[model samples]
Target chain A: MGWISDFLLLNDPTLRVVVPGVLLLCGMSAAVGCFTFLRKKSLIGDAVSHSVLPGICIAFILNGEKNIFYFLLGAMISGLASVLIIDYLTKSRFARNDTAIALMLSVFFGLGIVLLTYIQHQGNASQAGLDSFLFGKAASLNKDDLMIFGISSLLIFLLIAFLLRGFSLVSFDDSFAMSIGFPVVWLKSLLSVLTVWSIATGIQAVGVVLMAALLIAPALAARMWTNSIIKMLLLAGIFGMLSGYSGAFVSYALPQMPTGPWIVVMASVIAFGSLLLAPRKGLFSQIIERNNNEKKILQENILKIFYHIDEKSGETQKAVLQEDLLNQRSFSNRNMRKGLRILERKNYLSNHLGAWSLTSSGRVEAKRIVRLHRLWELYLQEYLHLDPDHVHDDAEAMEHVITPEIEAQLDVLLGNPTIDPHQTQIPSKDE
Target chain B: MNSNDLWIVFTAIAVALICALPGCFLVLRRMAMVGDAISHAVLPGIVIAYLLSGSRNTMYILPGAAAAGMLVTVLIEWLQKRLRVQSDASIGLVYTLLFAIGVILVTAFTAQTDLDQECVLYGEIAYVPFDMMSIVDGGFSAPRQLWIASGLLTVLIIVITLGYRGLYLSTFDPGYATAIGISVVFWHYILMSMVSLAAVVSFESVGAVLVVALLTGPPAIASLFAKRLPLMLLLACVFGVLACVFGYLIASFLNASISGSIAVVIGVLYAFSLVIKKIFF
Candidate 1:
């Protein structure tokens, strides 16, 4: 508690303003971003960012200073105009989406640069504040800016909460929404306007170049965890808050370090962590499961070897020579030893002359693994229309992992195929 | 208009016509930003030429600017092909870096007396009326930029018109053109160079920023109305000349900062054109 008080006293004004303000802005913007990401309109955020520059510049010139509301309104117009023009061109001509996006981004930024330079040459000191919009200077926030951020965030939050169902339906399947009389056009336009509003609000603090990342990264990071829309929104909000707060803190701890880039770095950290370690879909989890399953398969195969020898002679199969076991099947010596030890520990096999025979449970497990392998091959070849040569490889991988429910679905889909594509009979569970 | 004024107008339009001719072809290839890039990127070349000659010889300056323009094209193309950056991003990155480097070098190295960043960005089209076109026998009558711009424009038009079909096929679908044995890459370089040359000659007049407007806006506006490439080229040239005239008039009337205002006006005009298209369509 003393340390917390000391920390608050040290950063005095930062805690009151810049830090909280950025958190509010990044949070609201990222929530909006997740919707845009799902809608496949990510780089349109790029267009909005660049296009808003001229709006802000024009608004600054018109208002003779940084009047946030006027600047935001003016920016919203250009943002709408940019989207509408690109929309028109793409609709009317031979323009690819990338071309329209790239074109609008350059021309608008060029025009703004030209205007900005001209204004600078004119030597208006108020316009001096306009340079912050180029690369952003979030550390300079005051109470007024924070108030604007607070109100804007409140409004956006309300807008999202009130329209949650409509938004979800619109984002996931707009064509279906339209069929069901959801006024898709209005919803899209509303989203575009909100996007522009957030961009306009952000430009003075975080600038334009990094604003798109703020709009996209949090949601992208959140997406790695779950497919459920409600969870996605909540996780994205949390990630956004983490990035925003930590970025502000780092920038605070080290004087003169830019806030926006740190925010991006933190957000990317979360995105990368989720990419490699999220459950069910994370790289590490998948790799670990695959390793464990392979180990189980190896043990089962060794048990099968012991069972094969035991069934052949009916007495003292373990005393047979290892050479005889090698001739019976193409098992390597190292794998044969590992499998024999596992079976022996479980009391399923005794390798006296390196000829192993399985106990009852080991024989049953081996039969199940072989049955699954052949069943999947049957499913793929019959139901998937895959050729025999192609079916074997996929079946070979999926056989160890397919659950009973999946197998039941496969049975229903393939109508209980009795034979594999290679003319081998598929052993049923009962058999 | 007086007969002398008429003759000047004829010459000016004649020169502009040659320039506008190439502008048409460039407008089609969609290497419009290359013109903008070259126009700005030629400053180092000009500065270098002035350094070498210790004077602004049209001969030295033109080639110098052309060389610099070509260098920019090469840099942008290399960035595009080798790095696999998108052509648009490459254009933005290359031009900004070159323009900034030129500005910084000019400030850092030399006495801060002569040209500065604004002069480079805005150019001095207003003073073209003062530049004398001199020869051994012929007295200085015409502005030399007009003559050079017109001459280069003529060469550009002749080449483009001769290779117009090949160029059109290449622009519309390079894969199809390659299948048909067109040297798509060669024509692309030729087209890029022509834009570079056009930009070099016009660099002093329209300025660096507005040159982008001329190249992109006219073609884009022309495109809104025309379906055929030839018609689009013609309309683009007409729009280019109209923008110059109206831009000149508006700059004169407002007594505003001429070059910057002209660019703003062109932007406004492009927006108006978009609105018109939307309403009518």
Candidate 2:
């Protein structure tokens, strides 16, 4: 609690500088990252981050001072150069996109390292803090750095906010944007510039090695929760800001911990959590949905089996033994018993000793399933010119899926028929 | 040249050769970034292994780093296949997460040790000549990194020579390979494992970034000249060795990081090849 108050109150001078710097950096990077993610160019962010090292080193070597503005300019230039080279290499027949990306990333970073070691050997006093750009020194940021970051982040944010429509259009379908008379090329170049700008600015907070995570993780996590670009941008920003805050706090509490890795770890945790747990598209939820659908199909299949048995014997409510149900289909014994128990619990079936019979409501529901199956089979036979034997398997699959509206349409399309293509009496809806 | 210079060049050539061998297959399969990913992700495996074994022996660290590399490939596959994440995003996500964890582990526990974060990115290749291992009692000795690298290279060359057909078939036409009863999945994993091994072996001298440079740069440059697989592999190795020699020379002249100079030289060579292709071909 004491630490929490200290963190929240920003009692420490270092915390005051680091906390806002990280939040602004991460939030803007994430907001820009969504477009890159949508364009399926997320790895380009990684390449740009790595490529900025040489730019920073060159800026230092030339300026002979630790000017933040010159570093950003140099980083942005090299970052853009790397991106353009990757694009050209990918377009060429020789190298693939992945190869081009890896080539540019390692080579540029290597050059940066070369210059960096050279600078170290020269013993330049100002070159002491340049290596911090490699791994980030968030706590070392001063008021002037914060002012620069705040202004740049605000400009990028407002720019994105104003051109949201064109940006989304270019990301989703550039050709369509072009056809609609939008300046596709200009918009694309602007987007690339924005991407490089964000990476160059954010690199100092998270370092060259882990900067891509700040761009990608929040956007990816936000993507899992949304389909709209606006919502994704907002969610990604919030997620980024949250990770930034927590990462700064943790590094503050434990002075030994590095801030950049902690920030990446927090963002990754959020992204992985979203991937595994978000609704509908999430892995766990999809698995659960699939399991429930299978169970429903199994239960309906059991009901259809009972209805078929009743139809043959001309006894609407006759009880059937478990063996009778098992003999009709190839269902395993465990699944059959499980389905029967579940059906009975739902009052769809009444278990009498060792036998089971459909209840009144269950018979009605069972009748509808059978009717849909027969209707689909007849429709496939009459309209598709298929043999009666070929229609049953297809209808068997569709029977559990057809909604009531589709059932009526099929009934009307089939001319309210009472006889199926196999010359069996179709179950009437009212009955 | 002095013995130190000779020994450094030898180590660099060995590392470049080892990385370029598996790197050809990675490039052919268009999975070069996976090599990049594994190179970074092996860090945590290294730290955890060091913690458990409490030794810097290759016996402990190699397997740990190799295992970590395999985990990265498997996780990327799972994310792509099962979770339906796009391939690039998944690669970016998994490697960065693992790398972040590695950085954390290094800072938290290994701060007192020799394995610092900077060393992980930019390895101490120039210092390789100093860490000698005596093969005989008061007789012959060699740098420890050279012995480890040479042993790994021998193993790698033998594996590639023995498994050439399977590797060839799997990379070129996986469906046809499967039709002929060759297990595509098995060969894919085998190649990935070899890549992991190469990355781990090279991690000491060149560090992760330069390992990627060696892995991708040589093969990419070679593909412009060679069409056949064997020729491509030979050319890749040749270019890799050349890069090593030139990089070492440049590093000595500039008094800079050896691995970094090698990477820059590889880039220069790649550009040179591109220019050659434009003029001659």
Candidate 3:
């Protein structure tokens, strides 16, 4: 409790400076990241981040002192240059976009490394902290740096709020935006500028290499929770701030831990967490949904097999042995037994000794499935002009999926057909 | 040049040749960023291997890092194919996460050891000449990195030579290759494994960034000039060697980082290749 209050109350001066600065940087980058992500230029953010290294080095050389403003100015310039170079290379047919991006990223970072080593050898006292940009020095950010971050983040937020529609339009459908007489090119440039600015400001916290993660992970995590662009932006910002706060807290508590990687690790944990546990789009939910769907299909398929067996024997509600059911359709013995027990529990089937027969409710349900299957086969044969043999496999898949409304529409479309293309009697709803 | 210079350049050339071979296939497949991802993802493997072995032995570290590289490839594939995540985002997410964990591990556990974050990002290639290993009771001595790099180069050359046709067919016309009973997925993973091996081996000498530069840079320049696969492979090796020589010279002249200078040289050569294409071709 003491530690929690100490942290939340900002008792430490370093925490007071680091916390707001990191939160602003992460939140803004995450918001801007959604645009780059929607534009399918996520890797471009990576290229831009790597490209800023040389600019920082060059800025240090020119300014002869570590001024955050000049460092950011140089970073934005080089970052934008890298983006333009990638765009040109992609457009020039010289290389594919990925190739161009990879090339630009390595070349710029390499140049930065060269310059960084060059400055290192020069033995300037102020150059001592420049290497910090490589991995970041978030714990060392001063009050001036926080003010810069606060101003830059506020500026980015306002620009995004004002041009939200245009940015989204360009991101989702640039050509459509162009067709509708929007300033597509300007909007794209504005978005890139915003991305570069956010990245330049944020890299001081997370460093150049992992800055792309800060940009991409929060947006990706937030995307799992919402569909609207505005909601995605807001949620991404929140996720970014949460990760930033936690990363700062952990690093502060444990003095030896580096702040940047921890921040990235926290953001990734949140992103992967959302990926696994989000309600609709998460992997866990998706797997569960798929399992349920497969179960429903399997149940419907088992019901259809029972109807087929009854039709073959020219009897209704005849008790069939387990072996007899297995002979009709090759299901795993385990799945067959489990499916049989489930059907019995639902009152769709009744088991007497080892033999099973469909109940009245089960008969009606089974008849509807067979009707849908034959009706689809007839519809495909008549309307699609598919071969009669090909129609059976097609209907087998559609029977489990066609809903009642679609079934009625298919009935009217097929015009009350009693016989399928295979000349089998099609069961009607009345029967 | 002195023996020290000769050893450094030779070691760099070995690293370059090994990277360029698999890199050509990566460039052909348009998976340059995957190469980048593998390079960064090998970090944790190197750290964990160092911790387990209690030494910076290449024997232990190479397999660990190579396995880490393969994990990145598999994770990216799973994310894209299974979860329907976008390709670039998956690559970004997986590598950065692995790299972050790697960085944290390096800072936390390996603080007392020689393995530092600086070496992981941009390695100390200049010190390669000093880390000597004497075989046969001090009868013969050479840099251990040179030995490992040369051995890996030989293995890579043999593998690439033997599997050229399969790689060629699968890379150029994967659909047709699959139709003709070539397992595209099999060849894809095999190529990814080769890339992992190359990246891990080169990582010790040139670090991760320069590893990416060597992997994608030479092949990219080679493809601009050569029309055929064999020619492209040969040209990529040639360009990689040239970049090593020139980069070493420049680094020595400026007293800068050898790997960094090599990357810059590669960038220069690529620009020159583009200019020649523009003017003459």
Candidate 4:
């Protein structure tokens, strides 16, 4: 390993040549991957990659085996053609986008297979290197291949920077961007070409079949953690680079291990990690928030009963049986104890001889919750045209959730109604 | 050309008919890619059978190819469901990988044989007739690819025709079919296996790419002019025969590879059909 590093540094097998070269190419790829992810067009890469097979084969037939330049050019043309055909067909009536991509991917790749078979039949030794292009053999890549990748990565970075705003605007809202004088159609065509270029650049290292994952995985992973376009782009690039390096390292660690699928696996791990743990949008945060909300609601439920009993008879001193309240709720006695503790802490209700009653502060909180609930029910029934039965269930949930501004607004809008639709009293301010 | 020349066309027609029978269903199910996938995947199966038998026995290779085809179907389906990746991505991933593996193994193991990847692609259907079958005292018999293909096509046509209503109902709207109590997955597997078997038989003659074209193009061409299922299937057979016969003759006259030219011509024909339908209709 040390000797290899020494060689790459001194134009031998040293770290200087290998590490920096890999870093530059991997960094640019991950950056382009960010845009691809935000656009949600992963499979476009799949269509383009599979489409390159015949191109390389045709190049060999026409130019003989030695010309990497012509072969790569041919590969790029056919790869772009696959993308165009997919876009053209999917935009039409009969076929869907996914299905169109799948069809073209198979057909062109099949054609490439047939041609490669012919090349193999002739017993040319050059055909030996062709299969490596399927899953990508980054280690087999030489200084010549590295130069092509370096130039392509630079071109991609420059092009993206030049059109950053235009891409973002068009990606988010094509119609709005068009109205504002952007060439939405032309810009989109440019993006499509970029996708093909991305596919072509990665083909030598990642190979055809697995290059789609590189285009898709980093972008997908980036989306999990951000809303800001710049942040998303940056994060996506980071994920892409890390996945590339890690996939490269893993392949190095295990001899003969394919780079493309492993890179994809690494990207997927990034995506899944963000999916479970990213702030605000993370699944765990959402679940915890929801659980806390439900706990708070259960505590409020006990205070509500006391307010209800006093409302019917204007008898504030009645001691309602805890057993009776338990029957009315779906919560078990264990849950009720927790609720009672929360209620007692707030001085909402006190337990006396196993009976529950609300204190004065509790009565005010209960009346307000009930008022907000009925207001929402009225709002839904009036504005949204919901069924009264549906309104009750919805309002029951919304009642405790309205803010002070919403409560005031509803009060003014409803003309301070004394009774709800069910002939029950709709409590007001100062009640 | 004599009456014997008719056998060449007749045997081709028989092989084409068998391929087209399940092709109609494949096109309808949108499993046309699977037809191509299984066709290429059959390389390993044929290679394995050849290894064990030391002979290219139709008895051995038929099941071998079909088994390999089904394995691909199972692999793609399993990967798609288990990985939560999109179906198209999974299909593309599985087939290319399996095909590549098959290609590598072929070159590595049977390097001595003339069975290169290109022969596997277009297949030597023109050469199918020469493979020595059981020679009789009375008369000469056809190579069994024709007979086996004919039988498979017949069984496929019968199965599809019998279950036509159920198949159509599910294909048209599986959600609606399920709502009406049809077991979609049961009918689905039947179509998968039928298409797999058909593609396997056709692979040795037409090769893989043409399998996709035959499966998709004829039905697509028929769909342009015909509305009924029976009409579509029948016209597709006519279109299939036309593609095979005309495709072969044109390729032979040009001295081009039969399967590549046939597939390209089918693409051209499909495009032409669309153009004509557009301009006239």
lDDT of each: 0.67, 0.92, 0.91, 0.69
Give the runs in model 3 whose Cα sits over 4 Å from its true position.
Answer: A309-316
lDDT of 4 by residue, B1-281 (tens): 55444555666676667766666767767776666566657767777877777776678877777788888888778645643445544455455545555555565565544576556556677676665354465566766667777778789878988888778888879999999998888787777777777777777776655666666666666767777878988987888788767766765565555665555555566667768887888
**Please, what is the TM-score per model?**
0.61, 0.99, 0.96, 0.73
Q: Which scores higher on lDDT, 1 or 4? A: 4
Best by TM-score: 2
Better of 2 and 3 by DockQ: 2
lDDT of 1: 0.67
Q: Candidate 2: list runs displaced more than 4 Å.
A: B111-113, B136-139
lDDT accuracy of residue A39 in candidate 2 = 90
Cα error, residue A172 of model 1, in Å, equals: 0.8
Q: How well does candidate 2 reproduce the true complex, by DockQ?
A: 0.91
What's the lDDT for candidate 2? 0.92
Candidate 1: where is the Cα deviation over 4 Å? A1-11, A286-359, A373-398, A405-431, B1-281
TM-score of chain B of each: 0.84, 0.98, 0.97, 0.89
Candidate 4 CAPRI grade: incorrect
Residue A160's lDDT in candidate 3: 90
Pairs that collide in candidate 3 are none
Candidates ranked, most accurate by DockQ first: 2, 3, 4, 1
